[model samples]
Target chain A: MLQEHAKLITFFSECKELVGRKRLQKMIYILKKCQFPFSERYQFHFYGPYSEELTLRVQELINLGFLQEEKEKKSGYYQYRYTLTGEGEKFLDHYNLDMPNMDEHIEKMSETSSRFLELVSTMLFFEGMPKEEVEEKVLTVKKKQNYTSEELQQAWNFIGDMGIQH
Target chain B: MSYQSEQLREEKVFKDPVHRYVHVRDRVIWDLIGTPEFQRLRRIKQLGTSFYTFHGAEHSRFNHSLGVYEIVRRILENFKEHPDWNEDERLLCLTAGLLHDLGHGPYSHSFEKVFNLDHEDYTREIILGDTSVNRILKRVDPKFPQNVADVIGKTYSNKLVVSIISSQIDADRMDYLQRDAYFTGVSYGHFDMERILRVMRPMDEQVVIKATGMHAVEDYIMSRYQMYWQVYFHPVTRSSEVILTKILHRAKHLYEQNYKFKLAPLHFESFFKEAPTLEDYLKLDESIVMYYFQIWKDEDDEILSDLCNRFVNRHLFKYIEFNPNHQFEQWMELHKLFTEAGINPDYYLEVDSSSDLPYDFYRPGEDEERLPIHLVMKNDELRELSRESDIVEAISGKKRTDHKLYFPSDFIEALSDDSHIKKRILEILEG
Candidate 1:
């Protein structure tokens, strides 16, 4: 059975903090690509790779007092921010007893993770472009993501800088 | 934009021989396929020594992996109309289906047997370890990689999800039977997988087929029976497997006795120690194993060199159907005769028995996790498949064991003529 926050608490334990839902999904998706033992499965959904389970699990964590969510009205709509609570930290510490490798997984993910998580996730969001077609696919994908060529490179460059070995 | 419409720029497909086109829609799946670990499957043959029996079985696990994914994809589509289907588990099922065979090494059956390795455990390692596949799975969700492994591992709480890839009538079998049949150019494994999938419905804890598809289920069971005996159990493949097992045993024996060699068995040192690390095990595939076998051909150890040459050159030992109850005296006589003739029976004689072979048409309580296939009756009550389908019932729980006595025919024929031993052995074997 998947615990409410499940490995997400362990994930936040590694990152210290993950801000918005979009950022959280993108980062976790990147880690999933690196082959972390996550239970959420993603698709090339709205805002790069997305997992409905992540949303449900986050809500579950909120109910279970592991994560705190803050909501603010911005431009006539609600924007939310999330962070680990005191209890959440304690929960992570207690539940992560079995995960001796969490720190190493986080370190490896950071090296492979990019600031332009959107750009890289967007690059991967395309269904099946091989190495050769990556350039062309990215060109068209930029329009859908509202990303420029430079931003794509920055995301692509960040992945390159991380050394891509993890 | 709403949160769900993450369409790829285009649909991607792999040209698979059995499934034709293995469609990819998720960027995560496409990337997972590109990872070095997943690509390593290309070097690991699907059926191992079965290639000697059916040359076409040279297809790698990669081919079968894609086929499994495709079958799951089709099955998922069929489940779309069912009310209990959890759309959120869609990606999980597909991911599990694709990566289920991730941990297999080159010549998986023999290698795992000799080294006491389980590919299922390795699948978890690759998914949970700091590998590219793990990284990709993490992107789906932080805990997704493990869930995928769990589904493959059959530990997942979601019974329907687990059953899709693992149960008696799961995508893994549906794909392998057809794919293996296609590669081997055999007709026995062919069944209407499409109709069976169409009739499938997600029940509370199991995937059930409608009663209308009972005929199709019967056909699949029959096909499974045929494939097990006809292709998967071909005596030639078992002969090759016997030689392979003996090779590993001999090498381990030599290493234990501190036997030195012209070419060091570097790849096998861990295995010879009987404690192979994950790293050590990951490094082996068909190519490296073949390289070692080739090296052993010129070794100073005569038995080792001879066996290696036989395996490498496909001069496989011959086998006869051995019924122990009747042939017990003959079997004993062969062992004594071989010993008297100066041949080591330990290396030269083997009794290969295949029972509970993988993908067996098993009944419930026989397997730990799997629930036997159930059919939705006209009154909407669930009925076990074998209870209603005679074909399935006839074969279910039946352990059809094939025993073969394998020995070096050429060596026996070259024995001294005055003993008249070779003549008697040939008469018994030929009969």
Candidate 2:
């Protein structure tokens, strides 16, 4: 599960720099089906519905240096191509494959620090609850903790600084 | 805690597009914004008919008021940190900035012109008179409200506090420029506001920009210049103002002529008689004007009905560039042709000229007191902006003016087939 989470994060982070959300989602779907070093002709089937916003997002990704685009002359048409760089591949490898834990303290810290673990745990308990229910749960937690207003304000500030969603 | 101390509440915030958020830690500032008098700003358009040109610019004075407050808050924060800034005058500066536009009525410029009502006088009245804003201000200190009024009125001796809210590049102008740009969705009106704030220094008499940030100051001036042309002086906006002025004129004229209307002009009745109280003025906002315009669309007066429909539906008068000096003869000929075509030249045809000197280095004996923007040098010597910067020098003291003649294109198009006057008017318009 740890290896799977890392792989998903690496895949998203790497692809997000190259393509937009919709295209990246489609690319991830295709990769799950056919694996990497994707065929140019095979990807052409997915490029039917392109939008200006998508193009802009793709261009932004290209500017960010995540994906490299190549073009090959084929018959009477130019076949556009794309590939993940060495850096991207290394990121995926580093994140996906598990390693032997040298320090128990660091390993335990990583487990708690993992956003994916936290998200999964929270999702398991409150799978299809309404927003109000989630809010109520948060309020109940606050009440149970008996947090002061200043403490709450500090927590809110920390959350804002960390760019964490409520 | 004492009862009076308990009366004081925690900070309140209004999510504002211009200033991001208007923070009101003081009980007085928060209450002033909530007053019925101040709440009336929400009903008055900030740009006054500029929305007729820039469709997205439908923001009210309420937006600007909050923006002004935010800018003042930021200024006060900077001042509190600096030794040169007076800690005592913090509340005065903030209050003045927040309530600066308190006196403005709906379409203030036109209303003032027609009715001879001075918004500045009304602003003073609202602040010092028996009002909620005054009561809250007096709670701070007895003389506090008067000081705030004096600062806004430009009668205060403390130039430092007054300049923050009223000067050439003060909080008011800074907020409006950015707020207007954001609402209008224009890129030209953006200057590095963050940089400007960082470089602003509180001086003995006035606030001055640090000499190092001259580029930022130049950028601000350029933004103002662009906003003036692109937003403020937009010919379409002027055309709407023209139509609005004509509508008011027609209404006032009809009232004088004893012409009975379907619905009596309740809001405008006092204005027609050339006397309006503070209560009457407060009740008049963009909505009231709009309501009147809607009702006037069905009026028996042809000009009033036509103008009202044009204003409401945004069928604004089309304009062509014309210099009165160069095209005086042509203008007369066009006016004659308009009359021959059964179109009233007085109401339909108008020459509107908009001009502004973007930045002036110095004008020693000028009637309009414009303090030349001074940049504080590294060596602590003050140098005027144009002296050091080439870009600013090139544009400094240069006043640019644009003139355009507005007329109803639909009227000309709908003329009878036998009308040669329409052809003549078209020739003048095209030329």
The candidate that achieves the highest lDDT relative to the unseen native structure = 1
Model 1 chain B worst lDDT run, 10 consecutive residues = B361-370
User: Mind sharing the TM-score for model 2?
Assistant: 0.69
Candidates' interface RMSDs, in order? 21.9, 29.3
In model 2, pairs of residues that clash are none
RMSD of model 2 against the true structure: 29.1
Off by over 4 Å in 1: A1-166, B1-7, B356-359, B364-370, B420-431
- The sequence of per-residue lDDT tens digits that candidate 2 reaches over residues B220-327 is 877877787788877778888888888888899999999998899999999999888777877888888999999999998998899999999988998887755346
Query: Which lDDT tens digits does candidate 1 get at residues B73-103?
Result: 9998988867889988988998899999999
- TM value for model 1: 0.70
Quick one: best TM-score, which candidate?
Answer: 1
